[model samples]
Target: MSSIIKILPDHVINKIAAGEVVERPASVVKELIENAIDAGATEVFIDIEKAGTRLIRVTDNGSGMSKEDARTAFLRHATSKISDDADLEAIRTMGFRGEALSSIASVSHVRMLTATPGSSSGVMVEIEAGNVKSLADAGAPRGASFEISHLFYNTPARLKFLKSAATEFSHILAAVSRQAMAHPSIGFRLTHNKKPVLDLPLSMSVKERAFQLYGNEITENVMLFSGGRDNVHIHGLIGRPAYSRADRTYQDFYVNRRAVKNASLTHGLYSAYGDMLMRGRHPVGFIFIDIDPALVDVNVHPAKAEVLFRNQSQIHDLLRDVIREGLRAHGMPVISTPEATG
Candidate 1:
């Protein structure tokens, strides 16, 4: 038998990567939104049609890319975020892996138009299924715009696995909502089938953003709490014990401006509530954790939806105590258990 170990082609590799990053239409929204944020965008506009199965467009007024940069961005592992292994230790930008564009372009129809400030013209690149079809100068705005259509079109299997349009659209809304909460200063607008769903203008504070998203009802029901120790600060809106939800759908957590899901965070939150929290119900609030980037790992998750804290126990205890004390200060009765009091 002949030794048969053949290297996968670039397209095959790209499709494989797409499976990890572009799991669904919402995943595309998430990657593009993060890119816009990393580019220092102050405003991001998202439009989807037929729940993103037909079209998904994200426009951002951020530092646009150069013609060359635009071309290179679709190449796998081509990144401006990090240069060497040492840079990984202290990652700050939202996009570092450089796999998003290539991964996304590999699975859908992608067209990117980008131009820097003061530029008279912009560059447009059309790519389909990992193949660059066109690149040319065009008249455009001073930012970046990505239009992805027919998500997972090249992979029939993946496309077939997608949920109903309504379900997928909800996920897209949730994705945008998380990013909007993470960055209050950035204005976000979302439309589905050309109907406005969420229109949040630039907010000065998290409270203002909450108001924009949920109105005075949420602002009045939630309290603010902030505390830190040894460079780990935790701060955000915490719902009053009486104002919780039947599910965890309303809870939002961010670590270093990145939306994430961490068990330690959930545990710390529930622990702080102790028996004050009703059974089968979860708190409704936003939690923002600011820690030294070196102390937190962002590269562990494929989509960066989770992080690992070097001092997990310290963070847990700090979050728990801060919430508990804050609740106490607010005059809310917190029935602390022995474990919680200890």
Candidate 2:
């Protein structure tokens, strides 16, 4: 064998990365929503046809990208969130890897229409298999909308791995629900085959948001907490022991407004509530963790779903202890016995 290690071409690299990030149509929905959130969108609409196998469209009224930014967004490693090494540590945005757009375009046909708020005209670009098919001026609103067609067409193996439409659609709804819970101020709508699946309106408080997604039972038992050191602020709703879930699936955590699944913190919460709750029960609530952009690492995963907290232990402890304290404050209620008449 020749002793030579060659660099992979950009197209091949993107496709390989796509396997990790865009595992299914639901994965695409997650990334697109992240982009919209990062753009400061208050309202987001996700439209899926054929369980997102045929088409996935995400429209946002967030601050749209400029023409040049739109054109270069599909290039691998091209990102506006991070530039150098220091930028990685102070990441606040949901997408920092800059891989989602490129990985997405590498595996499917992507059409993007974006325009800044004050721009005279907008630009529309189409890409197929990582190649720019067209870029031109177009009439559009002051936002960005991405339409992905024939999902996973370039990767036949990935297509084979997809489940039934109903199963896939459920995954999409779960993701949308997580994001909606994380950002109570942002309005989100989901549609499948032109029929609405989830339509969540903006809420005044985090509890209201949780109630909308998880129902009143969980929110009714919710105890709110807000505390943090320095630039970090943690505000969330914790359910009472009576309203816990059967599993950890109902317990949701978010860092810097990005919904995440963290085992350590979730486990810590379970441990904290152990005295009050019985076995086979999990907490049902939501937590929004806020830290300075420089303290949290948003580049942990391609999906940007995992965040590396600077003081992860402290964060985990703080969350668990605060919740436990709130539960303890409501001391055990005593029942009065009535005198029996003989």
Best model per TM-score? 1
Candidate 2 lDDT, tens digit per residue, 1-342?
997989999899999999999999999999999999999999999999999998999999999988899989999988888898877767777788888999999999999999999999999999999999999999889889999997889799999999999999988988898888888899988899999888889888787888888786676778886666677777787777777777877778888888877877777567667656777878766777787877777767767678787777777777666666656665522122222211
Model 1, position 201: C-alpha lDDT score? 93
How much lDDT does each candidate structure score? 0.91, 0.83
> Which clashing pairs does model 1 show?
none
Q: RMSD (Cα, Å) of candidate 1?
A: 1.5
Q: What lDDT would candidate 1 get against the real structure?
A: 0.91
Distance from true position, residue 186, model 2, in Å?
1.1
